[model samples]
Target: MKKMVYASLLFIFFSTLFSLADTTVLKPSKEEEIRDTIVVHGMVLHGRVTGIGPQRLSFKLRYSDGTNRIAYKDIDSIYTKYNYRISFKRMDIEGRIVGIEENKQYLKILEGNHERTVKIADIDNFIMAVSEDDSFENVVRNKFPYTKGSIHAGLEVENGINRKNTADVRLNLKRKVAEHETRFFLNYNFETTQTADEPKVQNKDELIAAATYKNYFENEQFFFASLAAEYDRPRQIQQRWLPSVGYGYKFTFDKAFWLEPAVGLAYATTQYTDIQYQDDQFTAAALRLSGEYLMDDVIYINTLIIDGNIMYYPSLTAAEEDWIMRSNLGFSIPLFDFLSVKFIIDYTNDSNPDPEVGNNKTTSSLLFGFDF
Candidate 1:
C-alpha cells in the first residue's frame, strides 16, 4: 500500500511539473516590429529617423556628422523600426469610412475584421487628423500659412551711360491674412538726354504709388478698394490722389489665366503746377477690368508675366470736367532667381486737363529693382 501511495504521489508531482512547463512556454510576440535599414541609391544608411518629408529624409548617424539628406527618389526601399507602445489581442479595425447603411445601422469602412456599426454622427471631426509624418510644404500650405519675400535687381545694357542715361525703378509688395489681401506698388522713371546745345538735360521725371486692399470670398467674388497717389513733372501735376471703393468678380479658368471685373466710385484730387488751375477735386464713377497671363514655360525666358488694367471714369458732372480714363500695361521678366526686369506703360486721359497740359498723356518706364 505504501508503494502504491508513493507511486501515486510521484505521478501527481510529474503532472504538476508538466503543467508549469506548459504555462511558462513563450510564443512569438504579437507586436509587429521592423529594424531600421534605409537604402538610398545602393547605399545603406543606419540612423534614427528625425524627419521624413516628401522631398527628403533627415536622419542622424551614431556620431555627430550633422543631419544627412537623402533624396526620396534615390531611396530604393525603407525598413522602419516599429517600436509599438501597445499591443492588442485582436487585429485593429482602423480604416476610413466608405459609407453607412442607415437601414441596417451599420458603418461600412474600407478595413476592419469586426462589425463596425458606429454612428457617423458621433464623429467630431471631418478631416483626417494630421499625421506626424506630413511634409514641411504640406504643413506650410495647409495647417499654417507662411510669408516669404524676395528682392530682384535687373538692368538694361542697350546704350552706354554716356549716350543715353536712363534708369527705371520699380517695387511690388503684397500681404495676405486669411482671405484678405493687401498690395503696394511703386514705380519711378528718370532720364537725362543729351542734345547739341544741352548736355544731359533732365527730360523725364515721374512717380506712381498705390495701395490696394481686397477681401475675397470662396466663390470668387470680392469686395475691393484702393488708394492711389501720383506725380509727374512734365504733366504739370504736383500731386494726384485717387481713392475708390468697389466690388469685383474673379474669373479663373486655369492657373495661367484669370480676370477681374470691378466697378466703383472714385474721388480724385489733383494739385497742378500749371498757373491756370492749382487744385481740383471731383467724384466720378469708375469701371475696371484687369487680367493676368503667365508665360513662364518659354524656352528663352526664365519667366514672363503679363498683366494689364483699364480704369474708365465717366462724366459725373454736367460740365463734364471730372471725366478721366487711366490704364496700365506691365511686364515682369525674371533673369535669375531673385532678379527681374520690369517694363510698364501708363496712360491717362483727362477731359478737363490743366491749361498748359494736354488732354492725354502716355508714360513708359523700364525699371530694375531688388526683392528681398
Candidate 2:
C-alpha cells in the first residue's frame, strides 16, 4: 500500500508540471486569422501624450478598428507633450495580420508605431473635412432666394353720405429671378367711394380703379427700375385721369441698410360732370427717397419716404401742385421653409389738405405670402 501511494504522488507531480508547460505554449486558432486584418479610414481619433520632451512621444490611442476588440497602443513619435486633435480625411489606415491565438487575432500597424492588434473587419473610412473655403462654397450653393406673390381682400369703410362700406380687393403677382436681383410685378385694385358732397353731384357711388406694372433690377452695389401706371379716380372735388413713368436707384451699405431715390412723371386730365372742365394735360413729376434696415434671417424694418408731385391741365387753364410724405414700419416673419408673413403700418402726410379729405392717413395690413 505504501508503494502504491508513493507512485501515485510521483504521477501527480509530473502531470502538473506538464500542464503548466502546455499553457505557456498555447496560441489562438486559425479561425481568428481573418480578424487580424482591419482597414480604417476617415476617422478622427484623439490621444494623450504619455512621455514628453526632445526625445519621442509615447501616445496611447484608444480606438476601434471596425472590430469587437478595443485597441490601445503607445505610438513613439517626435512630438511635444501637449494634447493634440488630429483628423483623418479620405485616407485609409491598414493593419497587417500577425497572429491568432485562443480565438483572438493580433494586428500590427505598418506606419504608426506603438500600435496594437485589432480585429480585421472593424475599420472605418470616410471622415469629414474642415476648411473655411469649403464653408463659403456651401453658403453660395445654399443661399435663400427671394420671390413671392399674394392676393388680399378687405373691407374699406369711409365717412361719407353717398358711400357705405365697400369691399376692397387687390391682386398682386410678382416673380423674382436672377438671385433676387431682378423682379417683375403686376397689380390691380378696385374700390368704391361716395361722390363729392355738393348739390350738383350726380353719381352717389363712384368707382376708383388703378393698375401698375413695374420691373426692378439690383446688384450688390445698386438697384435700377422702370415703372408704368394708369388711374381713374375722383378725389375731393375733381375727377382725374393719370398715367405715369418712373426710374430709381438704390445704394447699399454694410449689407444691411439701403437708400433708394426715385423720380417719376405723370400726365393728368381734370373733368367735372359729363363736360370736361379741364381739357389741358399737365405733366407731373416727383422725387422719392427711402431707407431700410434689415434684421437677421427674415425680419426687417424701414422708415423714410418723401414725394413731390406737380400737375397741369391745359383745357382747365389751371395748375396744381402737391407734396406728400410717408413712412412705413414693418417686419417679415418666416412661417415655413417657403412661406412668410409680412406686417406693415403706413403713415402719410400731404402738404395740401382738403378739409373734406383727410390730410394724414394711417393704415395697417398683414400679408401672407410665399418665397421661391
Candidate 3:
C-alpha cells in the first residue's frame, strides 16, 4: 500500500510540471503567429500598421514586397492581432477587434466569449495595445521605405471660334521610415492657342522637378538637403538647377498642424535659350518656410487641407539683383475615399530674368487627383 501511494504522488507531480511547460511554450508561439489582416479592393493582406495619416494608413505588408498606404475610406475591413482600447464620446471599451462592418459604420469586437458592436460615429478613436516586445516604434523602425503619393492631372480643349489645348500634370510623393523623411515633386504643363485666322502659337511649355530629404533627431531638429531642376520655353530658360543644404526645427502644435522653418546655403545655375543672355551661376543664403493644416473632421464641406511652402534665395556671390524666390499654396478637399479636388497657386520671382520676360510669374490650376 505504501508503494502504490508513493507512485501516485510522483505521477501527479510530473504531470503538473509537464502541463506548465507546455503552457509556457505555447503562449509565445501563438502570439508570434498573430498578424493583422486588412481587406481593401477585394484583396486580403496580412501586415503590421506602421503609421496613420489623416486620410491614409501606412502598412508594412507580410509576404509582400514593401510598405504602402491605403485610404481609410477604401478599406473594406480590418482585423487586429492585439487588443485595442476604443474610446467613444462617452465611454471606452477594451477588446480584441474583430473588424469594421456594415459599410464601416460599426466596429465589431470580441470580449472574451462575448461580442459587442459599436457605432463608429459615436467613437472618437481607438488604438492597439502593443506588448513591450512589439512596440509601435519597433514596428515602424523595421519597415523601411514606407511611402505615399498622389498624381494630379487636368486637360482642356476648345474649338469653334478659337482653338486651344492645354495639359497639366503634377505629382507629389512622400516617404518616411525610421529617422529619415523625403519628398518629391514634379509638374509639367503644355498649352497651344490659336484664333480663327491667326497661326497656332505655343503659349506655355514648362517642367519642374524637386526633391528634399531630411534626417530627424530626438529633439525635433533635422538636417536637410534639397534640389530642384526646371525649364520653361516661354520664359526662355533652357535649364536651371538649385541645390541647398540646411538645418530646421519642427514645431508641432497639435496632431493636425505643424511648421518647419529652415535656413541654408544654396547654389543656383541657369542657362538661357537666347544667345544674347549669358548663362549664369551664383550662390545665396536659402530661406524656407513650410507648414500644413489638416482638419480631423469635416470642418467645412469636407475635411479641408492646406499646405504650402516658400523659398527665398538671396544672392551672396552675385549682384544683389540676382536673388530668386519661389512659393506655392494648395487647398484641397477630400472626395469619395482616396480622391481629392485641389486648387493650387504657384509663384516665382527672379531679379534677373531673360529678355522680354517679366521678373515675376504666377500660375494657378484646379486639379483632381487620387492618392496611392
Candidate 4:
C-alpha cells in the first residue's frame, strides 16, 4: 500500500510541474520521512511546501528534483501540517477554531492571504504555509525574501551634565527563506568625559559586529549559529572574537509584540592593548533574553518603539571568573517624514577587568537623525 501511494504521487506531480530556478535546499542533517498530499486540477500529489504567499502556493513531490507552483485557480484542496488552509463557504467547511469575531460576524483561521468568508459557519479540510524544508538559498530566492522586517538602521548622540559627551550608531539586516533567517548587526560608539576631580579628560571607543543564522520549526522553536567581533578601549581590550551555536524560542503576544529566549556556547578570545592584562582567551556559555514592542502613532501623533537585549554568562569552575552580563534598552520616535529622535541605555559588567579599570561601564545617549 505504501509503495502504491508513493508511486501514484510521483506520477501525478512529475508529469506536470516545472523546476524553480535560483532555488536550492540543503540536505537534512537528520532523516525524518514526511510528505503532504495536494489536490489540484483533479490530480492528487504528495510533496513538501517550498513557499507560500497571498494567492500562490508552491511545492515539490517527495523524491523529486525541484519545486513548482500550484496556481491558485487550479488548486482544489490542500492538506499539510504547517501551512494549512481550509475551505469554508455556503458550500461547506471548519477548523480547530483559534479565533472568532463578534462585531465583524466572521472568524480568522490560517495566516496570510488565503482567508475566506463563511457566508455561514463552514470549513473544508486544511492547507499549510510550509513544511519541513530548510534551504537558506531557496528561502532567499523565493517569497520569503521580500516579506516584512528585513532592514533597519539608526544613530544617536548626546552631551549632558549627568552623562559624558557620546555618540552611537547601529545597523541591522536580515535575509530569510521560509523558516530559516540570517541576521547581521554592526555597532560603534565613542564617549568623552571630564570630571571635577580629574585634571585631564578620558575618552573610550567600542566597536562590535555580529552575524547569526536561525532555522525555525513549529511552536517557535529554532536552532542557530553566531559569529561576533568587538573592540573595547577602556578595558584595554584591543580585539575580541566569539563564535557560538545554540537554540532559541520566540513568544508572540500579538502583531506588534514578541520576545525570544536564547542560549549558546561560545569560544572567546581577547587582546588587551594598554592595560596590564595583556591577552585572555577562554570558553564560556551565553544566555540571552530579547524583546521588541511597537506602538503606532501613540498619543495620536508619533509612533513609538522600544526594544531590549540582556545577556549573561555564569562561572562553571573554581579557576574561572566567567560571570559576565550586558544589557541594552532603546526608545525611538519619529518627529517627521525624514527625522527622528532616540534614547538608549547600554550597560556591561565583567567579573574580571584590568586593575586600572572599573568592573562596570554605562553609557546613555539621546540623539536625533534622519530616517530612510
The number of the candidate with the highest TM-score is 3
Kindly list the per-residue Cα lDDT of model 4 for residues 1-372, writing each as its tens digit. 999999999987775453322132433424333455677778988766544432334576777765555544566666553443344322222222223344323434444435544421222222332243345533443333222231233433444443466667776666554466788877777767755555435476888788888888665899988888888876777888778788899987753678999998877777778656657666778788889887653675436779899876654452246556778898877564335677889898775567667677887777666542
Query: Residue-wise lDDT of candidate 2 within 90-207, one digit each (tens)?
Result: 2243222223332332223333444444342222111111221146533332232122334444455566665545443334344333223333333233444554664433222333
| TM-scores for all predictions | 0.56, 0.37, 0.65, 0.54
Better of 1 and 3 by TM-score: 3
User: Model 1, residue 13: what's the lDDT?
Assistant: 100
> What order do candidates take by TM-score, descending?
3, 1, 4, 2
Regions more than 4 Å wrong, model 2: 1-148, 152-172, 175-247, 270-280, 290-292, 297-329, 347-355, 358-360, 367-372
What is the lDDT for 163 in model 2? Answer: 57
Q: List the residue pairs that clash in candidate 1.
A: 150-371, 150-372, 151-370, 151-371, 151-372, 152-369, 152-370, 152-371, 168-367
Off by over 4 Å in 1: 1-164, 318-320, 352-356, 368-372
Q: What overall lDDT, based on C-alpha atoms, would model 3 receive against the true structure? A: 0.78
Say which prediction, candidate 2 or candidate 3, comes out ahead on lDDT: 3
Q: Which regions in candidate 4 have their CA more than 4 angstroms from the true location?
A: 1-166, 192-202, 300-302, 318-320, 336-339, 370-372
| 1-372: candidate 1 lDDT, tens digit per residue | 999999999999999999988876643243312234567778886654443322344555534555554544456655544221110121223343333355423334443344344442222112121342255643443342222233333334334444555666666776555467787877676666665555766656778888889888666788889998988787777888889989999987544578999998888888887777658888878788989886644676745779898988775673366666778898887554345677878887876465556788787766655433
Worst 10 residues of 1 by lDDT: 83-92
Per residue, candidate 3 scores C-alpha lDDT tens digits across 196-315 of: 899999989999999999988666799999999999888888999999999999887754688999999999999988888889888999899999998644644536789999999988
